[model samples]
Target: MEGPRASGGRAMTGRSGKGHRDENFPVASKLLRPEHRAPIMAFYRFARVADDIADAADLSPSEKLHKLGELRRGLDGDGAPEAVALARTMAERGIDPIHAHELLDAFTQDVTVRRYADWDSLIGYCRLSAMPVGRFVLDVHGEDRATWPLSDALCAALQVINHLQDCAKDYRALDRIYIPADMLAASGAEAEDLALTAATPALRDAIVATAARTRTLLEVSAPFAGGIRDRRLAAEVAIIQRLAESLTARLLTRDPLSERVHHRTVEAVLLAGGAALGQLFARRRR
Candidate 1:
């Protein structure tokens, strides 16, 4: 994990399309432990802002790169509002700045690089974009490397799944493609095939294969549930695992190109509740 330091600045002002400070903090709500919520929210806000800057359609490559550099400087204590807030939250949580920086590197890469030559290159992007975030979460829960590696695999798999789902939007808007070129070529699919109203058999098959690979990674990392000593944290991991399983199932059933598949609000609640209860029951039996 390597990247820029967060500067000690104030919270970012002004709202974009969604005029909410906490919109980007996906998992930060009453659901999490009160003590952990604020810091995690702040971290998500910081990452979201960085991502927006890198991915904004309005900005030119130079502008995006320049802003990212500024963000990097801010992370180093340059005193921008978001940077300042993130720096404080990170310090309070004792989160290593390296993960924050690594994320910046990932966003920077997104702004500059649009295509990956092979699976290895795509995996390398996952290392910067996804693995560090998982490592940071494990660190917050006081987990060690034994758990970190598997957690990272799961996180990277999640990222890959997300990329697969967002392929259409990413290509049409951001001019980015996370699908490996070689894989597409081998399957006789093209980037243009992703924008089709329905997935061709080749494209469908490619996505299914990719989903299977991600599922394998999740399976390898399944034992992570037992490593979390905190009950809440264990529940969180279980919920994530269930979500991954659900996403994989959906990918197998539907063509990702035609319609996006997602867990509905009720479905999400059911899955999370069921997973948490299952974990609690297992612990009680133990």
Candidate 2:
């Protein structure tokens, strides 16, 4: 809740005080090489700043758009400190700013777009919002472009999982809904239902249905880690895949509106360990 404020005393960055450790999946964990971690963290901070701006409750749409534009400009050489840091890292690493640009575009869309019409529409948004992140990471590792398909799937699944996990809070606090309107209609649920303290049967059905679709994405990305050439990055991917699978399963059976769906710290650590081992063995088999 505590963040920078504008002259009017409105919060400028809607930072939830969440860092990489607070994410649903690991970010630039110790598994990564030191060189890779710095640039990745820089990219993450840029993203965090942009996301906070877009989600800032106190900022009007115009103000949010303007702030996002500043970040976009930063990519070009002048902007916010976070954006400048990311640009410096990208320049030093020879990583393209295309992904960062795409992410800014997505955040800009968040300023005005409130609902998705269908699954395809939602996936379209993910293409802008989620896929770029994986692509950016792969670029950081200097991994081949061939790895992007699975990465895209995994990233999108993770984004949707986060959406499902925070559905209630997002709806109640921001009045922004990411679940497809059609999906809600099919389940006899309305967007307003998400505001409830507990999910209704119909709302649960919609959330479960979304989880099922996200499960398919997880399936597609199941081999993501195996496709990566970087051992450390591959291991990280495996951990993320495992986490996504577990969360998707939880979404199917748990109520996001009232339940604790995210993994506890110990659970996440164990899952990461097991996934790392599994990836190691699988790679050795080849």
Candidate 3:
């Protein structure tokens, strides 16, 4: 999230200047064809708008819900430019609006839900918040619907990686903690540990436990890229998988509250390069 932006000349809940680049993974990156990229960016902006509303520190829960409703109406036909744009793209591409509506459901939950009770509950949230984004992209590419289960695994892993990386900031800034209560309790840690300057031993244990679980999700998604029939989209998924793997490994060892968990630009480029070449080679052999 960043500074607010004006929506069509009027103030729309703090617009958080957060762009695709600020995201943990690629968004409409160059890996996909230009036609594919356009609709993806539209969907991303619509999502960003809803996310900004849900995350606005200044807004009350009621206000957030109201604004989210307006965004939803926009998705239906007319609302905000962002929502209208996404709706138009969906219509043009013959894509269903269910995925976008599912995302709105997650954002609506974000307005009211602050803590996750267990791993099952956390994954349930990801089913709404993360899984649809991948499905939407796959739809835009006209990929087989059969590929969704693997895509769901990869997207859920990415979502958890983000939760782990932003744990402390989310706790302090929003009072929202995604680290499941059961995991925290099992490690003798409490939510307050996130407020400290660094992670306590218990907090570290809980985080590592979450990271380990995320790794399992990644393993289940290992066949995802190979399963995709679209070469470009397959390559993009491969790059994202590598990035998720690197970040998950960092979370396992480094304290995100005290240490940098994200990759530096040079390192990310190298990892993406390697993954792209490997994906290309694997496709050639196939």
TM-score per candidate: 0.89, 0.94, 0.95
Candidate 3 TM-score versus the reference: 0.95
In the range 242-273, model 3's lDDT, one tens digit per residue, is 99899999999999999999899999999999
Q: Which candidate comes out best when scored by lDDT?
A: 3
Please list all clashing residue pairs in model 3, or write none if there are none: none
- Name model 3 segments beyond 4 Å from true: 1-12
lDDT of 1 at 95: 83
Q: Evaluate residue 69 in candidate 2 and report its C-alpha lDDT on the 0 to 100 scale.
A: 91
lDDT of 2 at 240: 90
User: Predictions ranked by TM-score, top down?
Assistant: 3, 2, 1
Choose 1 or 3, whichever is better by lDDT: 3
List runs of model 2 lying over 4 Å from the truth.
Answer: 1-14
The digit string of per-residue lDDT tens for model 1 on 1-286 reads 1111111121233123332232211254354577776666566667767777766666777877888787778777884567678777778777888887888899889878999888789889988888887777666666676788777877777787778877777776666778788777778888888778888888887777777778888888787777777778777777777787788888877886787676677888788789889988988998
The CA lDDT at 97 in model 3 is 98
